[model samples]
Target: MDTHEWQKSSYCQEGEACLHVAAVTTAETVHLTESADPAHSILSTTPAAFGALLRVLRDDDRG
Candidate 1:
């Protein structure tokens, strides 16, 4: 797959080695990948699933 137009979030801080995300409307899925390796490693999941996971993570981080 071509990854020329993917836009990563500016919030991806250094040293956390977090995942980067891109919107793929054709598939209705969000693409995820390591910020350190944009071309080599990628993952895809539904927006609903990703949002749920993000909510759970955010809740856990509050404590």
Candidate 2:
């Protein structure tokens, strides 16, 4: 697999790591990993699934 350019959220404070996300060039999936332990494991999902997750989180935040 090709190396991906992972990006952390701007909301992350300095020295305080959070989830990092990257797009897979070979597939229509997004890769996710914790910044503090990137070598351990990664979560892969479709863009639609990721969007749904984000939407749910955002809706929950407003309630």
Model 2 lDDT, residue 17, Cα: 62
Number of clashing residue pairs in every model?
Answer: 0, 0
Candidate 1 residue 40 Cα shift, in angstroms, is 1.8
Clashing pairs in 2: none
Best-fitting candidate, measured by lDDT? 2
lDDT of each: 0.75, 0.81
Where does candidate 2 stray beyond 4 Å? none
